[model samples]
Target: MAGTPTIFLHAELLPNIRQLTLHVSLPNSASEIDIRESTITLSESCRAVTVFTLHQDVELVETLKLPVKVTDASRRNLSFAGHRVDIGGTESKAQTAEYSFRLQVDPNDAGLTFTNKGFQEDDYVPWTASDMSTCAALHCKFCKQMIVDVASKPDTSSWQWKDLPSGNWAEMMDFWHCHKPDVHPDDKEGQKDIEAQNASVKGYGASNRVVATPRTGLVDVASFLVAESDCQNIKVLEQRPTSTSAKPASHDGKNARNIGCSGCSAIIGTEDSVAEGLRLYKNNIVVKHTGATEHVYETHSIDIITSSRFLDLIDHEGVRRFVIHAGQSNGILLWAFNPDLRYSSSSADHSIVSRRAMKVLYQNATDVERILEPENGVPTPLSLEELFLPENIYDELVLSLRRSNLLMPISARIFREWNVALLDRIEKRP
Candidate 1:
């Protein structure tokens, strides 16, 4: 409805029949186009014309003919979403008059073949956890220890302060949620002071919906990772006490200690006596090279690592060079390569020479140049070829690219073209 309504036609060839389906998008007001009044005619023995009048004045007509003979024709008016028709090939009963269209086709006597162009080869398909596991291992960036086996227990969870309450009990719940000192008073005098302060507040003694309920597992909780029990492997690098008067309460109603990786001294998460478990922050931990290890904590669901996680996997050396290209739907295409190890070599290595040269091209090319430049100044774009890469590297790159929302829609052909362009540039530089 936003733009000119475009109709798409699909044709399939069977042994003795050629099936043609027409998908039409009509304006919201133009419902139920009388197919009986519409006209379909064959011209030049290969072209077909469909004409219908809507709103008594607006005439919708299409003219195209294929090499086929007319045997029978049928039309049906149905209500459906515009997107369903865009996807094509799906059959659904009419429910509403939001979207209306018609279909017309005839039997083939000229023996012309029919093919469906609705589906593309390069359409995006999501990667499974197993696909990702095959490319890289989940390990701690600092110690390089197997922190998580994503293939087995792919799920992660998190916890956060619950929403503040309202009414007389609002102040009390706020104090607890914020870990206020009065909520964890040390003496009867402090408790009495809090009670006396709220005494003037109406409905202070009345019970309301705001109440603390104990929950297990990560359902409806913040993102968290079940850390290994060996606290020795991880150190409490820094501690921010939420309670100024006293230590914060843990699961056991005792003091809590924020913890971190002992190896890298990076703030990883918190240790609460009340929770009696090491809760790792989802953002703090790194996932690197894969290895086989058993999970330290129980899991309910598998958390599929997504494109945003690619940043965490980058190492100290970082990427050799990177570029961003404007993509469809206002997205961005990110191209990055790992730092070249061949640069450290003394002699002139062909692989290293090619890699360095490719890096120069990437660093120097403008966004448009990167995507449109010809290989060796040839007319064809550099991406219109096959790319050669190590299996592991290719898989890793594909996974990251597919997961990233920044990239444009990836069809198999587009992915191959992009991959080839990048790899070919690198491999052919020397």
Candidate 2:
């Protein structure tokens, strides 16, 4: 019994009841004090959750948002007005908790609503793949500007993200869960290397668990991924026992968790210190970020086009957009393939295409985040033509190459020599 409390309620009302309300009885007698805790304690992390979506047997265009009705016990209602999930350029006009989600169509007068209740309150989503992780781009630790603002350098101090083990995606996921750098349940595998490989597969770029954004995505899912250049962080949460665990458990029925002496609930934030491992946030999820040990800018072996393969598998509907290092391999990779580029083939010998990434581009992307692609944003591809074909292409190439961790310029002749040597490699490749 910790000083703080968490109670959950689920119920169904008959057609006759116009409204349903929930009331929770706490040990505290002061009303103002208790109310403040709800605001500070339960962050606005709770959004709408749904078991189903619009179009029962139709092609899916976008992931529909379904609002959730949350309240305490005693069946009292909450006064959270202005409720709706924004969809396809339109916001639901309803202020009710459980509203029917409908794609814009005439037959959908009934809109969207969930009556059967698919998941209970204390379901305990304990993995990076948990449903809540993809709530919105704001949830991703690396992508969201507020967490790791574009201007703020990458969490260089965060553990150097070791590339996940080489294995199938499923195996990588399993490995991530078992060998999470921090809290993790003791699986039957007993901390084996194979388990770590599996977790890395599923856990890569996942929101609940943080990793590097530039390399986020199931890259090796394609056979084209002959080798990996993956690098990012991992965390495993420690588990507590019914009565045998040494760490204090959470008072909220969810999971008996540890509590601070002053009584702030445990939350993982972006302060970059203890924030690296854990913190005490109410609703928001923080993916523990350890800086990468490897320099991602290192000139990678051109053995396999792993970057191009990643762009191919992006579920553009479920995603918002990508934040990549300017002129890095990812941009070059996307230009080489991405079907949406209006190009016929990746290897078609044509003009060099690339997205010129500015330091400000990433630094400015604090609020823009998406799991698939930015709903209102477009994928920015800094092309090579912008920096590599004109009057002073060499000068621009020098900077770009330097950024790519290629040859550094020592003198005019030295730069020309390095330039000739590099172009020679590309020209002879075919």
| TM-score for predicted model 2 compared with the true structure | 0.17
lDDT per residue (tens digit) for residues 1-430 in model 1: 5453322222112222243333333333324555345444444443443434353444656443432333434323222323233212223223112222333335344332322111122111122222233323334444545443433433443212232221124556555546845444458688776666674463344343322222211211112324344234566544442322212324455444656555665545566443344654433444332353444321111111221122222221233233332121111233443211111111111121111101111222223343444458667543221121212222444444443212211111133324411221111111
Off by over 4 Å in 1: 1-139, 146-229, 239-257, 282-406, 409-430
Q: Pick the candidate with the highest TM-score.
A: 1
Quote each prediction's TM-score: 0.22, 0.17
Give the lDDT of residue 124 in candidate 1.
15
At residue 26, give the lDDT of candidate 2.
18
Per-residue lDDT over 1-430 for candidate 2, one digit per residue giving the tens place of the 0 to 100 score: 6433222111112111222211122122222222322311111322221121122122112111112223222121232222222222223212112211111111221211222211121111122223222212112222322222211234543211122233345455656657858535675456566645654674553333432233232112111110112211212234423222111222223332221212122222211121122222212222332242322211212111122222222331222123322222122111221111111101123222211111111111222123123355766433221111111222333344334322211111122212211110111101
Q: Model 1, 284: alpha-carbon shift in Å?
A: 4.8
